[model samples]
Target chain A: MHQSRLTRWFFQNVGLASALLLFAVLFLSYNMMHPRGFSAAVAVQNANETAAIAFLAMAQTLPVLLGGLDLSVGAVMTLTNCIASELVNGSPAQILFGIVVTLLSGAAFGLMNGLIVVYGRIQPIIATLATGAIAIGLALLVRPKPGGDVDGDLGWALTNSVWDFADTYGIAGGGDAWWIRPFADIPVPVIIVLLVTILVWVPFRRSVTGRTVYAIGSAEGAAFMSGLPIERAKIAAFTLGGFFAACGGLYLAIQTSSGNADIQQAGAYTLNSIAAVVLGGTSLLGGVGTAVGSLIGAGILRVISFYFRILDIDPLLQPLIEGVVLLVAVSFGAIRTLRVKNKLDLFR
Target chain B: MRISVSNENKPILIASLFIVVILLAGTVYTLSTAGTAPLLSPKYLLQQLQTGSFLGICAAGMMMVILLGHIDLSIPWTLTAAAMTATAVGGEMALPTALAVGIAVGMLNGFGVAFLRIPSMIFTLGVDTVLRGLMVAQTGGFAPQDTATPLMLFLAKDRLLGIPVALFVWAAVSVFIIVMLTRTGFGRSIYATGSREGAAYLSGIRTRFVTMGAFVVSGLCASIAGVLLAGYSAKAYQGMGNAFLLPAIAAVVLGGTHILGGRGRYIGTLIGVILIVLLNSVLSIMQMPEAGRQIIYGTVIIAMLLVYGRNQRVTS
Candidate 1:
């Protein structure tokens, strides 16, 4: 009985442990491929992709938890990036202001989504789809083409390593910069990602408000009857989603060193974010989830993308793979939910 | 079951939005185009109506599935398969035979969605990929070299009494669907299943049949749309169906349909389709870049959704 219980526990928690294992394997593979100069810079590039994807996944989680999905993350990112590039007026302060405005805009967007879902009584999917179209349209108005450049100094600072910490000590050597060179100097985006994991994810798991979100997601009527502020929690969840989307946009700007309104063209982010959330073992039907799971999900996605790049697969074929992966992930999630639904009155 | 009636009542407010969007599209085009009067021009509006009605034929069918709380993401490919099949086979046989083949493919889609227990969205998406691949492989990513019969071209190109034939087809299908939904046991079961699955099951609704029926209808609509479009464009090129997906969903939503299912209006969808086509044409006439046009389209739709939802709440 003890052995069986232990084995079940391992099976249940294996997702996260294996995620870390995959991350380690990715790094090892990279090292083996490039024997002499495989270093922190590569890790930083991977970090940047991981951070952006992670942030987007996190943003999407809140709405999905409430049985909603946000298709507008990419569009919102485009809008923010467009503004950051054009409205910054060539000053760091202005660029910072743009960043602030972007987050505010995201929050406002989320609030609208929540309002529509809760008060407007619109279906979450339809509401988001409508809003996503609007967001993309607005991004187009901001910059028809990918013309505007972010503040040069800010871009350099974000992308380039200033001080040699581990890399300088020869632990991971700093080298020439590529368009998406891993941040060797300061790696601010990765830092922000880590900070979010600590501050947001941890609190989200521990705090009452956070727990209530899970409860609401798992069973809204029960939570409502139990005196949890169901409506507020739902609104807060969507609003938080908006904020994270904005953060992801900022990280994306840093990664590419410029924002293309069309960069969000690929529908990869939306599906990938959902996949990441599910692969991290977050329940699709909402309620049971961990932020750490999303992180692992994000990591796995990045690794897969990197693996594809290393293998030199045609870019177009990637969508087919992504579509398949999305189907698989959703299938797994749906099955899991169905299994739980059979036993749990919570589904009602 | 009683509660869903109240829920269905909510979508009536979305009908009002169709009016708003149409008016908005009209107003925007009027102002931006510097008095083109294209909005009032029957010929121009007829063309827009015909283009959108091609999509409407499919939307009418999709609306049913959506009302039952499922979606058919594979309309793109179904249409593609229909188009390719018709175009490839139209040469050797009469048009009816080719159309039948296309419709049969749609039946297969219905089978996959209904009997296999696959989520319609995922199942269709996968099938869409396979269909797209088949289309590409068959045509080598270009229009086939079939010398289309004059009858085929005339069917595609000929306007009946100044209105496109496609519009007539669309009108017929829409009416057929409305009748089916309002008058049939199967249709009522769809509403029941969508509103509450457990209750539907308890009521002895053949939920799978109801669900599968929607896909079959959608498949049929898609093929019809493909036939119409293939006639209109004179070829069923790769990704011809791509532009239709968003607009189709938008038309449904704008028509007062709930994405979660159980409620929608066909007339509202018709209006939604008109509004979208009008918006797209006007935006193009204004020389907006692709990105700008997309952004504008997105913004207006989102704003409309919010307003529609809020208004519904206030009225209740």
Candidate 2:
């Protein structure tokens, strides 16, 4: 929303509100009903599960905003997770090196997608689908099974409470730790998520390349006519998307402390991320959304699963609920089309 | 007349030539490695067609939706749900129940894509998730623990005069689609609608009905395949249809059916299905691993699409 007056100006962007508002309501209600109300430990665990999908939804957000789709984000994550599990072990230096390699591999997969889509001129859906298949094949070649050792200490340090790191780094200053003690129980993954948002997404959203991405999504023809960097922006969107997917993959490796080369997992994550993107108030037609909205949408999805788990509902029915959520959100967006009086206007 | 026909059907002719090349390769590999001429053996070829029948049927449906410039991503679970429901119903009701389930899902897909104006890819994908959840919940994450009805067995396994009945089933669907595309006004309208829905609507095409009809046809095809698969296995199970999903689409696309929906030939699709079937069996004969098969499978689809799709440089 934006308003201008002679004396002052006011603006509010409600695009990111749906997912945030829904997640906030669902999260608070669930916390209220929980056995332990809003503990940092609980908060951390929620973040750990939500983080991977959040990263994935954020990944999906870029392509959707570019008026394209990436069905391979899950596959890329799966590939990198296997790589991380296989390499992120042994000596500390080896682990550090492995982590870098793993992250780079994710970027490489995204880069591959970008190349295929932009240079090869393949439709994004088909391009991503093909690349995704290759990624899964590679993942299977790497692990071939569900078991791999992520360094135990590393996984624990990353997944568990942040008390030790805070105290050691003296985030509260060297004088006293009392004020920060309560928050010390906050999980490292949650902080990593926040840091990623603040450090990466925020800056990217404000960048010229990001503006180009939005412009491309809204109207590629117009963007091209205006002499925008269409090819570079598209490639950038895919590479960044792949990088985020890799973050998801690494998180999975750390969270599970192992890796699985599961084909079903790739399909599941791809579909769910899409649903999250849709729920996040991003138009599938492209050109209208934010990573924050996608992040919140992801949170809302994970919360539905978590809330049901607390209620002790049958695990089998969980997907049904999630699917219904996706259907409703998708249809909710479609309501706009129904309002168009002229049938011809439907296409535009 | 012959020259004009050849020019119009160039893609199909190209794929047919590619099929021959693939067959030659298979023969060379088989004879050189296995010391067998099974690639050309009538018995072997017939058996392969029987296996291809299911994929052929599914692709037949997928091609219809794609022909309408829409995709049905719900095929996998729709097939499973149909098969599972059929087995659960059993006996005389099995066939009807399977078809009914498919029709219902198709109608929902049609409603969303046609009337609601939602994109077919995501809408059907959403429905796919819902179907998977419902099936898993229905079976409680285990096998359906049901036997194929006698009708399914007759349809899937019982050979007719030495050729598998499955081939006949595939043939029926092929004939129906060919007739629909070539012999019916509805089929022509599907092309018109796909080429440009607004133009088709303005021309009084009732484009929505055509779209819904295509989806319903697709659903029925998937349902038929599901029933046959369940019969072949003699039981219903979860995720049984997962394997067919992409291969079916691949077969359609490879057959020279345009992914963008409007221009394609049924004959090209038929040949494409045959190519996929032979390639798969040949790969197994060569003792390729599952992982390698997946890589080649994806590569083949992309390679074929690149050859023919020549997509416009736009994100949408």
Candidate 3:
């Protein structure tokens, strides 16, 4: 606890730094290898595709930070994505209403998870698994055939290049706007990711509830002894996590201009987000890591998919490569355990 | 120490009670509609048991890991890979190859989880994905065309004493697990390690070995189930194992093996598997849509857990 400031900073930010570095390296490789090489369109398309998993990772980071796992985040994403598709079309007002409804539904489902895990005293993992199954069922009922659509205009705006979006809205960053030139090609999803970080995560991390969540995760009994509002902090963590997952779903709807309540997709998203969180350096044991690291981790994961395509690997081998890369990436986390001589230290 | 072990018997008792309740409810619903006690009929009961055997096998290994408070998420692809390996080899070498695939996967899983100190949940998940990739690569992305061999089919489908061969296999596995648990040092170590890893280690137990051993058992069980499923279906395919993972976990947990680990009985898991199979049957008998069935399935698990699993209350 009394470590020097420089040493403390390095150790504390190592996960985030490594994640950022990995994302930079992998993404640069992808960009360099692409035929379109460094084009705004390419960046936006990648960002749009990566946005869903990023948000899901963001959602997963919270429960993990609170010393729990929300296995329902993916199911919530599917549910909200289905709802968004059904309601995000038609008139502007209708689209607005639909978006809110979709997001709120995610919050509600998340709250249900919180209630069950906290009040019902069930393990967060199993509890979320059960609730997630129900949410997926709801998603299926909402979109049995998967043909719902997001409003064409909204989808286009979010999925397009930032410069194009600026031009359409007559914003200052339109063509030849010198001040914003460097950011002109910035993807809307990138902006959205920043916006979420600033609006939600920054505030939460600075707030009392967020600190309490960390305290509880690191040592629940000690946190309780310290008289923290453990239950509320947990509920808040879950509720916020759900909201993030909903945003992920909304992003999915916008990115695809439609919705799919496919079970496989749900499973994939949940697993991938956890992978992202793990890669981001968040301890599954809880209490250590940042959402930004997870977002960067998610980016790294998505970049690998593009890397496969860019490298011209056989399409059949993509999944295999992806799996191997993930395994290797996560295996890095295991190295610290190798140095321990005493078997009892393994538990810690 | 001399006190009656009433608490130890609770899980089995509860599972048995649920079995009866589910049966009665299914019977009542069926009688009111189809006018046939299909739920009570011997043929239907036997069929449910046969279908449940695969899950029972999966749960048996899962129970070992769960007993140590860990999980094996690789069951899905382990089953797939085993089936694929067995069928791809086709004949005298089939069964051995399939079991070998399982033991190898389990060994890898145990190595990572035990030696590497990676959480079993994520490590096994990664392993599952890799296995899926390998299987997909082997088949060149399309479903495999290989068929289950004669002996495989016999083990999965043949019957004697008017019972399904699968039932006998399940019984054999169950007997093996029960004996191992009741009669071995490694078995006691599972419960001890689960309750407290540090203490288990301090007490001179090789907790890592126990952890690895549990994962190997789970992998072997998953492999067995994979072979049986392949035999039952006449071929193996990707995602065929998908339906089994969660349901197997649900069965093991439902049987009162504490999800967090340390306490559970194989008989309870058996009852849990039957209860689940019957529950699904009842849902189909009532003509519930797939969505409705899922909703009810999730609800039932939560409700049951709430009843027996809510001992660790919050805000206390």
lDDT of 2 by residue, A1-348 (tens): 233551241113344665676778999999999998698768877878888998999999999998888989999999999999998999989999989999899988898889878888877877788788888988889989898998877887787677755544456663247886666777788788788888888898888888999998889989988888889988989998988999999989988989898998988899889878878878787898888888888888889888885797888898898788878767765767767898698854
Cα lDDT tens digits, model 1, B1-316, are 3634344344455545555666566666677658556666778878777777777877787787788777777777777667767777766463665467556655655666555455565456656665665666567667776534455566667889887877778888988887887888877787887887667766787766677677778778887787777777787667767767767887887777777677666667766676777777777666777767776776667666665544232110
TM-score of chain B of each: 0.86, 0.95, 0.96
Task: Output the chain A TM-score of model 3.
Answer: 0.94
- Please compute DockQ, using alpha carbons, for every candidate against the native two-chain complex: 0.35, 0.56, 0.65
lDDT of 2 by residue, B27-82 (tens): 99988887888988999999999989999999999999999878898999999999
The ten-residue window of minimal lDDT in model 2 chain B covers: B1-10
Which has the higher DockQ value, candidate number 2 or candidate number 3?
A: 3
- What DockQ would candidate 2 receive versus the native complex? 0.56
Q: Label model 2 with its docking quality class.
A: medium
Model 1, position B4, has a per-residue lDDT of: 48
> What TM value does model 3 have?
0.96
Measured with C-alpha atoms, the lDDT of residue B254 in candidate 2 is: 75
User: lDDT tens digits, residues A58-106, model 1?
Assistant: 8877777776677777667666666666655455577767778877887
Best model per lDDT:
3
Off by over 4 Å in 2: A1-15, A164-183, B1-10, B313-316
lDDT of 2 at B75: 95
TM-scores for every candidate against the unseen true structure: 0.80, 0.93, 0.96
